[model samples]
Target: MPDVQIRPVTADDRSAWLPLWKAYLTFYKTELPDAVTDSTWKRFLDSNEPTNAALAWQNGKAVGLVHFIYHRSNWSINVSCYLQDLLVTPEQRGTGMGRKLIEHVYATAKKAGADKVHWLTHETNTTAIQLYERIAERPGFIQFRKPL
Candidate 1:
């Protein structure tokens, strides 16, 4: 695991962080303009959005990020942590940082009083799917959505 530590991201990380962010977007085939990224980077700094979190190097390089949010759950009084984004730099992947990062979030969620941590991954994301299988049990609830 090589002491992969997760900490709150900082403004200085922007340069190191952007490339991984782009790679993550490429992985999902989602596109966004620079302005949206511009605003989002600011939003996290504002601290109004607990929905945001990022992980970086203790020695000062960006290794990965996990964008999550805590929200009230229907079945439990405790909140839910929805892991919206997780990305580890390509060179760092498969070296166990991904697992460590998620484990990091699991511990964070628990400490934050979250009932559970949840997220969705494409079925074709076999690598991540394998990791998820090892790290946590699937809720077995397939997700579906549509625009109103």
Candidate 2:
């Protein structure tokens, strides 16, 4: 609890957000083309897009980031929020920054009339899973995907 402030990313935040974004990708051992990263940043700033992102700031530095999206669900009339990405700087982990970021999304989604918020993480991500389990339930769903 180091006087953290969570807020939606502003245009001026690209500098602060990029390092955290890169760290997040590094954590997952993934890489994306510069074009994809550029597009993702634009989406966050676009009011028309359902994709949204926010950063956790501490002492004027961004220590965490969360990206969420709202989309229609076949099982519910109201939209469902997918908490797509969440990452806290290694030094900030276990300081509750991650939870605060998620709570921010929860409030935002609730205000938007979303039916639920859900996400998936690799099974090996036990640290994140621990935090997630405390705040959300696992419905035991398995994900299947095929890249075209």
Candidate 3:
């Protein structure tokens, strides 16, 4: 296979991005409202929004997707980056595409003056944890959330 090329998502990428987005959501066994997805996509295209998306392409097809956001953190002067979502097609999972997508986000965050980049994955996702452990540190933080 050819090397994967990573690029910031454009408005034209919606058709390519949606399938990956749904796959990611399915992996987590969760779903979001269509309106929310629409808003998120729009945010990625808006220059004023801190959220962004990128796609990993191979042979002229989008095979992976990542969404990251920059946010203020009280601990630092520079904004921190949250790697919110990462997804690669099932067939492409173990082919280094995930790591490449992460590195792409790291490069983007660095360019945007972000202090740190962080993300979370379910404990059950052992396969991903294996790869993530090699590329990034496990800060030993557990996440908790409550829906409003």
TM-score for every candidate vs. truth?
Answer: 0.89, 0.98, 0.97
**lDDT of candidate 3 over 1-148, digit per residue (tens):** 5788999999999999999999889999999999999999999999999999999999999999999999999999999999999988888978899999999999999999999999999899999999999999999987888979
TM-score of 1: 0.89
Q: Select the stronger candidate by TM-score from 1 and 3.
A: 3
Give the winner by lDDT: 1 or 2: 2
Displacement of residue 106 (Cα, Å) in model 3 is 0.7
**What global local distance difference test value does model 2 have?**
0.96
lDDT of each: 0.82, 0.96, 0.93
Query: What's the candidate order when arranged by decreasing lDDT?
Result: 2, 3, 1
Q: Local error of candidate 2 at 37, Å?
A: 0.1
Best by lDDT: 2
Once fitted onto the true fold, the runs of candidate 2 whose alpha carbons sit more than 4 angstroms away are none
The CA lDDT at 20 in model 2 is 91
How far off is residue 126 in model 3, in Å?
Answer: 0.5
lDDT score for residue 61 of model 1 = 70
Q: Pick the candidate with the highest TM-score.
A: 2
